[model samples]
Target: MDWFYGPMVQMHALLAWCSVGLFLVRGLGHQFGGAWVMDERLRTLVFSSHLLIVISGISLWGALHHDPLYEPWMTAKFIALGVYFAVGHWALGRGEFRVIGYLLALLALGYVAAVSVTRQVLLGL
Candidate 1:
Protein backbone atom coordinates (compact mmCIF):
# COMPACT_ATOMS: atom_id res chain seq x y z
CA MET A 1 0.00 0.00 0.00
CA ASP A 2 2.88 2.36 0.73
CA TRP A 3 4.30 1.94 -2.74
CA PHE A 4 0.84 2.54 -4.13
CA TYR A 5 0.72 5.98 -2.57
CA GLY A 6 3.46 7.53 -4.68
CA PRO A 7 2.16 6.24 -7.98
CA MET A 8 -1.39 7.09 -7.08
CA VAL A 9 -0.42 10.67 -6.32
CA GLN A 10 1.41 11.01 -9.60
CA MET A 11 -1.41 9.47 -11.56
CA HIS A 12 -4.00 11.66 -9.87
CA ALA A 13 -2.02 14.81 -10.53
CA LEU A 14 -1.46 13.88 -14.14
CA LEU A 15 -5.09 13.08 -14.70
CA ALA A 16 -6.15 16.35 -13.06
CA TRP A 17 -3.92 18.35 -15.35
CA CYS A 18 -5.02 16.38 -18.38
CA SER A 19 -8.65 16.98 -17.54
CA VAL A 20 -8.10 20.72 -17.23
CA GLY A 21 -6.12 20.87 -20.42
CA LEU A 22 -8.80 19.00 -22.34
CA PHE A 23 -11.46 21.33 -21.00
CA LEU A 24 -9.42 24.35 -22.00
CA VAL A 25 -8.97 23.06 -25.50
CA ARG A 26 -12.62 22.17 -25.94
CA GLY A 27 -13.86 25.37 -24.39
CA LEU A 28 -11.63 27.55 -26.52
CA GLY A 29 -12.30 25.60 -29.65
CA HIS A 30 -16.04 25.74 -29.16
CA GLN A 31 -15.87 29.44 -28.42
CA PHE A 32 -13.81 30.08 -31.54
CA GLY A 33 -16.20 28.19 -33.80
CA GLY A 34 -14.16 25.08 -34.30
CA ALA A 35 -16.57 22.39 -35.44
CA TRP A 36 -14.14 19.67 -34.49
CA VAL A 37 -14.61 20.58 -30.86
CA MET A 38 -18.03 18.96 -31.03
CA ASP A 39 -16.69 15.70 -32.34
CA GLU A 40 -17.97 12.68 -30.44
CA ARG A 41 -14.53 11.13 -30.13
CA LEU A 42 -13.01 14.18 -28.50
CA ARG A 43 -15.94 14.46 -26.11
CA THR A 44 -15.50 10.79 -25.24
CA LEU A 45 -11.83 11.32 -24.55
CA VAL A 46 -12.60 14.23 -22.27
CA PHE A 47 -15.20 12.18 -20.44
CA SER A 48 -12.81 9.28 -19.99
CA SER A 49 -10.08 11.51 -18.65
CA HIS A 50 -12.43 13.09 -16.13
CA LEU A 51 -13.56 9.65 -14.99
CA LEU A 52 -9.96 8.63 -14.46
CA ILE A 53 -9.27 11.77 -12.48
CA VAL A 54 -12.09 11.05 -10.07
CA ILE A 55 -11.06 7.44 -9.67
CA SER A 56 -7.46 8.40 -8.96
CA GLY A 57 -8.48 11.10 -6.53
CA ILE A 58 -10.56 8.67 -4.52
CA SER A 59 -7.74 6.17 -4.50
CA LEU A 60 -5.31 8.78 -3.21
CA TRP A 61 -7.72 9.87 -0.52
CA GLY A 62 -8.10 6.32 0.67
CA ALA A 63 -4.35 5.74 0.62
CA LEU A 64 -3.82 8.83 2.75
CA HIS A 65 -6.60 7.84 5.16
CA HIS A 66 -8.03 11.31 4.80
CA ASP A 67 -11.30 12.23 6.48
CA PRO A 68 -12.65 15.05 4.40
CA LEU A 69 -15.31 15.79 7.00
CA TYR A 70 -12.62 16.80 9.48
CA GLU A 71 -10.20 18.33 6.97
CA PRO A 72 -11.20 21.87 6.15
CA TRP A 73 -9.10 22.02 3.02
CA MET A 74 -10.43 18.73 1.73
CA THR A 75 -13.95 19.91 2.45
CA ALA A 76 -13.25 23.13 0.62
CA LYS A 77 -11.88 21.27 -2.35
CA PHE A 78 -14.97 19.08 -2.44
CA ILE A 79 -17.20 22.13 -2.47
CA ALA A 80 -15.17 23.74 -5.19
CA LEU A 81 -15.27 20.53 -7.18
CA GLY A 82 -19.04 20.61 -7.04
CA VAL A 83 -19.02 24.19 -8.23
CA TYR A 84 -16.65 23.23 -11.02
CA PHE A 85 -18.98 20.47 -12.17
CA ALA A 86 -22.07 22.64 -12.09
CA VAL A 87 -20.49 25.60 -13.86
CA GLY A 88 -18.60 23.32 -16.19
CA HIS A 89 -21.87 21.75 -17.32
CA TRP A 90 -23.26 25.11 -18.29
CA ALA A 91 -19.95 26.20 -19.73
CA LEU A 92 -19.90 23.37 -22.20
CA GLY A 93 -23.55 23.67 -23.11
CA ARG A 94 -25.21 25.79 -25.79
CA GLY A 95 -26.22 29.24 -24.65
CA GLU A 96 -25.05 32.82 -24.23
CA PHE A 97 -24.13 31.91 -20.63
CA ARG A 98 -21.33 29.69 -21.82
CA VAL A 99 -18.62 32.33 -21.56
CA ILE A 100 -19.58 33.39 -18.06
CA GLY A 101 -19.92 29.79 -16.97
CA TYR A 102 -16.54 28.95 -18.43
CA LEU A 103 -14.88 31.75 -16.49
CA LEU A 104 -16.60 30.72 -13.29
CA ALA A 105 -15.57 27.11 -13.79
CA LEU A 106 -11.96 28.19 -14.20
CA LEU A 107 -12.17 30.21 -11.02
CA ALA A 108 -13.55 27.21 -9.16
CA LEU A 109 -10.73 25.10 -10.52
CA GLY A 110 -8.19 27.68 -9.41
CA TYR A 111 -9.65 27.66 -5.92
CA VAL A 112 -9.40 23.88 -5.81
CA ALA A 113 -5.77 23.98 -6.92
CA ALA A 114 -4.88 26.65 -4.38
CA VAL A 115 -6.54 24.75 -1.58
CA SER A 116 -4.79 21.56 -2.60
CA VAL A 117 -1.39 23.27 -2.53
CA THR A 118 -1.81 25.42 0.60
CA ARG A 119 -4.22 23.13 2.48
CA GLN A 120 -6.01 26.30 3.50
CA VAL A 121 -9.70 26.81 3.10
CA LEU A 122 -9.26 30.58 3.00
CA LEU A 123 -6.19 30.32 0.74
CA GLY A 124 -3.83 33.29 1.37
CA LEU A 125 -6.01 34.71 4.08
Candidate 2:
Protein backbone atom coordinates (compact mmCIF):
# COMPACT_ATOMS: atom_id res chain seq x y z
CA MET A 1 0.00 0.00 0.00
CA ASP A 2 3.00 2.28 -0.16
CA TRP A 3 1.78 3.92 -3.30
CA PHE A 4 -1.52 4.93 -1.71
CA TYR A 5 -0.35 5.34 1.87
CA GLY A 6 2.60 7.51 0.94
CA PRO A 7 0.50 10.10 -0.76
CA MET A 8 -2.16 9.95 1.93
CA VAL A 9 0.39 10.65 4.62
CA GLN A 10 1.90 13.47 2.63
CA MET A 11 -1.44 15.05 1.97
CA HIS A 12 -2.39 14.85 5.62
CA ALA A 13 0.86 16.50 6.68
CA LEU A 14 0.45 19.28 4.16
CA LEU A 15 -3.11 19.94 5.24
CA ALA A 16 -2.06 19.98 8.87
CA TRP A 17 0.42 22.77 8.23
CA CYS A 18 -2.08 24.61 6.11
CA SER A 19 -4.52 24.41 8.98
CA VAL A 20 -2.04 26.17 11.26
CA GLY A 21 -1.65 29.02 8.85
CA LEU A 22 -5.38 29.24 8.25
CA PHE A 23 -6.07 29.70 11.93
CA LEU A 24 -3.32 32.28 12.19
CA VAL A 25 -4.71 34.23 9.27
CA ARG A 26 -8.26 34.08 10.56
CA GLY A 27 -7.22 35.06 14.06
CA LEU A 28 -5.03 37.95 12.96
CA GLY A 29 -7.72 39.18 10.62
CA HIS A 30 -10.23 39.22 13.43
CA GLN A 31 -7.88 40.73 15.97
CA PHE A 32 -6.59 43.40 13.62
CA GLY A 33 -9.95 44.35 12.17
CA GLY A 34 -9.15 43.29 8.64
CA ALA A 35 -11.77 43.44 5.93
CA TRP A 36 -14.83 41.33 6.67
CA VAL A 37 -14.93 40.10 3.10
CA MET A 38 -11.36 38.91 3.28
CA ASP A 39 -11.94 37.26 6.60
CA GLU A 40 -14.93 35.46 5.14
CA ARG A 41 -12.80 34.19 2.31
CA LEU A 42 -10.26 32.82 4.74
CA ARG A 43 -13.02 31.30 6.82
CA THR A 44 -14.49 29.64 3.76
CA LEU A 45 -11.12 28.26 2.81
CA VAL A 46 -10.65 26.84 6.30
CA PHE A 47 -14.11 25.33 6.30
CA SER A 48 -13.60 23.75 2.90
CA SER A 49 -10.29 22.27 3.90
CA HIS A 50 -11.78 20.45 6.87
CA LEU A 51 -13.32 17.69 4.74
CA LEU A 52 -10.11 17.10 2.86
CA ILE A 53 -8.16 17.05 6.08
CA VAL A 54 -10.48 14.49 7.57
CA ILE A 55 -10.23 12.29 4.51
CA SER A 56 -6.46 12.38 4.51
CA GLY A 57 -6.22 11.77 8.22
CA ILE A 58 -8.61 8.84 8.12
CA SER A 59 -6.74 7.38 5.21
CA LEU A 60 -3.50 7.55 7.12
CA TRP A 61 -5.05 6.08 10.20
CA GLY A 62 -6.34 3.14 8.19
CA ALA A 63 -3.06 2.76 6.33
CA LEU A 64 -1.19 2.49 9.60
CA HIS A 65 -3.85 0.27 11.12
CA HIS A 66 -3.56 2.36 14.24
CA ASP A 67 -5.34 0.82 17.18
CA PRO A 68 -5.88 3.60 19.65
CA LEU A 69 -6.96 1.10 22.29
CA TYR A 70 -3.46 -0.39 22.29
CA GLU A 71 -1.35 2.43 20.87
CA PRO A 72 -0.78 5.30 23.27
CA TRP A 73 0.87 7.47 20.66
CA MET A 74 -2.06 7.09 18.34
CA THR A 75 -4.46 8.02 21.11
CA ALA A 76 -2.40 11.03 22.03
CA LYS A 77 -2.27 12.15 18.43
CA PHE A 78 -6.04 12.03 18.23
CA ILE A 79 -6.39 14.01 21.42
CA ALA A 80 -3.90 16.58 20.21
CA LEU A 81 -5.87 16.95 17.01
CA GLY A 82 -9.02 17.64 18.99
CA VAL A 83 -7.21 20.24 21.05
CA TYR A 84 -5.92 21.85 17.88
CA PHE A 85 -9.40 22.15 16.45
CA ALA A 86 -10.92 23.53 19.65
CA VAL A 87 -8.25 26.17 20.03
CA GLY A 88 -8.52 27.12 16.37
CA HIS A 89 -12.23 27.56 16.70
CA TRP A 90 -11.79 29.64 19.80
CA ALA A 91 -9.23 31.77 18.04
CA LEU A 92 -11.63 32.47 15.22
CA GLY A 93 -14.09 34.01 17.58
CA ARG A 94 -14.48 37.77 17.89
CA GLY A 95 -13.55 38.97 21.36
CA GLU A 96 -10.68 40.15 23.53
CA PHE A 97 -9.99 36.56 24.50
CA ARG A 98 -9.44 35.57 20.88
CA VAL A 99 -5.82 36.71 21.09
CA ILE A 100 -5.15 34.24 23.83
CA GLY A 101 -6.93 31.56 21.85
CA TYR A 102 -4.86 32.35 18.80
CA LEU A 103 -1.64 31.96 20.76
CA LEU A 104 -2.82 28.75 22.38
CA ALA A 105 -3.84 27.38 19.00
CA LEU A 106 -0.30 27.84 17.69
CA LEU A 107 1.08 25.91 20.62
CA ALA A 108 -1.48 23.16 20.09
CA LEU A 109 -0.65 23.02 16.41
CA GLY A 110 3.02 22.59 17.31
CA TYR A 111 2.18 19.76 19.64
CA VAL A 112 0.19 18.01 16.94
CA ALA A 113 3.01 18.38 14.43
CA ALA A 114 5.57 17.11 16.90
CA VAL A 115 3.49 14.08 17.73
CA SER A 116 2.96 13.30 14.07
CA VAL A 117 6.69 13.44 13.35
CA THR A 118 8.01 11.70 16.44
CA ARG A 119 5.11 9.27 16.76
CA GLN A 120 5.68 9.63 20.48
CA VAL A 121 3.85 11.23 23.32
CA LEU A 122 7.03 12.66 24.84
CA LEU A 123 9.29 12.73 21.81
CA GLY A 124 10.32 9.15 22.71
CA LEU A 125 12.44 10.41 25.58
Task: Please report the candidate that would top TM-score against the real structure.
Answer: 1
Tens-digit per-residue lDDT, 1-125, candidate 1: 86898888888888888888888888887777788987999989988988898898888888788998889899999999999999998888888879899899989999998998899999979
lDDT for 97 in candidate 1 is: 71
lDDT of 2 by residue, 49-87 (tens): 887898888877787888889987778878877887787
Among all candidates shown, the one with the greatest lDDT: 1
TM-score of 1: 0.93
Q: lDDT of model 2 at residue 28?
A: 78
Query: What value of lDDT does candidate 2 attain over all alpha carbons?
Result: 0.78
lDDT of 1 at 80: 99
Models 1 onward score TM values of 0.93, 0.87
